[model samples]
Target: MSDEKNDKDRRGIQSVEVGGQLLRALAHHGHPMALKDLARAAGMAPAKAHPYLVSFGKLGLIEQDPASGRYGLGPLALQLGLIALQQTDPVRIATPMIAELAQRLGLTIGIAVWGTRGPTFVRLEESPAAIHVNMRHGTVASLTDTASGRLFGAYRPADEVRALFEQERLLGKLERPRLAPGTPAAPAPTSWKEFERALAEVRRHGMSRTEGAVVDGISAMSAPVFDHAGAMVLAVTAIGPSGALDTQWDGPVAQALRECADRITQRLGGRPPVPVRRAA
Candidate 1:
């Protein structure tokens, strides 16, 4: 089966049993790196590691920073991330909560599990209010583009996350994080300070917002969801164009998102995932 093959390929690339070691190093380094740094920190020769990094990049599973040449996990890495979370009906478990969130906040809501390409909008619950702009089901948005992606992308592991930084060009890629016209461009977080600041806000607030991070006048925010076995960022999401919610309720909606995702973790019958420390 293709699934089995992707798994095998993934194991060969990551050696997941020991992959955490490489990820930890990336977290500490806190900047884009040249290939030399990846192997040194990963405890392997750059020559031996070069092929894998290149392979990962070719797969869009990882990328070399054009600005700095460091390799980090790509969007494909997030696609690979769901291997653990899909063990249960993660979407179903999050359903009632997401719907309640929709009803209460009067904004379209959903949960996006992280993947190599970015956050896949796996579920959507629209507000009953006739005024809502409809968001589609099964929409996949990039971590660089949407609130769902940011909530999840900002939380991805560093070794696996570096590739998620803004890419310079897309001449030979399998996918592109969906970009809407007129959205302000985000310079890839090229340093730990910037990456850490984003992650810190996500943690402290349990989410982040954009006036139009993805689309002009379209606002969104999200939280994180964990599965029982420590699959982090299982799903946390919210979205709407400007002026959808009562200004006062945005805070409560955010809290509800965090609370509901946490409760869903328990409902799904697994121990909550440990927070992977934000990369440097």
Candidate 2:
């Protein structure tokens, strides 16, 4: 497994490259990054990290501050990221799919994962036409107000869903998905009856279908991906401004979307788990 991983890393980018990249982030930001901070930034485990980074510092690719014991780039690491963006391929594979979906659906299509926080957008591809909708990739997504957010919140474990608010930056609102700017926001459903009603629609339908939740004139539907380990690693959805989507939930597109979601689940390696917990 390690050999295969090493080969894959070599094809794309190396951990040494990532460690060096992480070091530079600390240096540019001008701070002492904790071990966990570096690990999170590099998508690595702390137990397996320090030594690889220390080796870079030893080579002067990065330097560790004595007072903080944090690593920073020593010049070599900076030179590398400056030269890197030329080789990333995950985006390459994901982009074509997003573009195709957007073109066909006349909506913005995106793939996002359940990061430690919320749905962290991994890639976003837009249609090439003159008029279209789009969202930035690599940004955090929402858990409220947007079509995809409803799907995410519905599928997410009741425990981890709380993490979205742990930082309290949102003031009980969805952060990444800015519910439409002018549309009247749903007054916080004061009762579980209201909240669970919303979730029930999303889960049973597979794709989160909504109207006027984000913008007064938009509609959206999203499907959660069942992952290899039977975990929902991500969800993909297509959303568009008001007129683009209509009462089409029972139409061909909607059926295709359901199949797509299930196919994505199979591709990821599991079926969405049968509902386990009873209503409290």
Candidate 3:
């Protein structure tokens, strides 16, 4: 059996491995690269890398910008990544980490994934103290009123995020009259400008937080988890009564949440998006 395994390992192609290394280098850099740089990173000569890139471009695994002569992952690569993400259970992978976080912090932890209705809580680990907030598995968090939702809003595609905000607006209107006559309306972003500003902050810091926005006296912080293709797959959130779970982005709870999300992202072979720099 050992010899058969060794035979199988030794039976493969070298050129294919070299081509895959180029793809891996492009993926690791997470940006388009000039031919020379890409070849250097892959430890190959530009002359040698060009043919493989041409083949990959024909197959839709890579694309070269005509203007800049830079190479990046192509649409087919994105499609393959989405398909691969579908096969993995993000919630299952996040469960143990969330459980450990809950136990250590004495705060409820939840994993929310992008569902048809937006960011939906798929799993929850309750804190030892019975904190009474209405979150449960399958609860569709309000995109404009919760940390988990805003985390998704900040990281998800713009079209999807806009749709979620529109849906939330309609729902809010429908549910407004149900509130007690004098109850104060929830404070939410009132304009696209405000919403974009909030999302910008989330993007800059790689997390989001809310204080009493979803549930009175409740606080929550959430960080995004990415897949191998740099797509957001889920979010890890920490929630508790306001006094227990600090809502500040730099607090211990927020740091732990971000670290847990980062760990999950790394485990899934994902890279965070590279920040763009403007002219000085």
Error of 2 at 12 (Å): 29
TM-score of each: 0.56, 0.57, 0.66
TM-score of 2: 0.57
Which is the winner by TM-score between candidate 1 and candidate 3? 3
Backbone clash count for every predicted candidate, in the order shown = 14, 4, 0
lDDT of 1 at 117: 64
Best candidate, lDDT: 3
Q: What is the lDDT of residue 12 in candidate 2?
A: 54
lDDT for each residue of candidate 3 in 42-146, tens digit (9 for 90 to 100): 999999999999999999999999999999999899898887767777778899999999999999899999888888888999998888665568887778777
Q: What would the TM-score be for candidate 1 when compared with the true structure?
A: 0.56
Error of 2 at 11 (Å): 26
- Deviating ranges (above 4 Å) for candidate 3: 1-87, 173-185, 274-280
Across 1-280, the per-residue lDDT of candidate 2 in tens digits comes to 9999998877955665766656656654666677788777766788777887778777777677788877666776556645552333333434555566677776667777777657777776564543333357766655666666667778777656544534323465444444435545443434445555778787777667777664556667777776434556566777666565554778755765666667555433356666856253
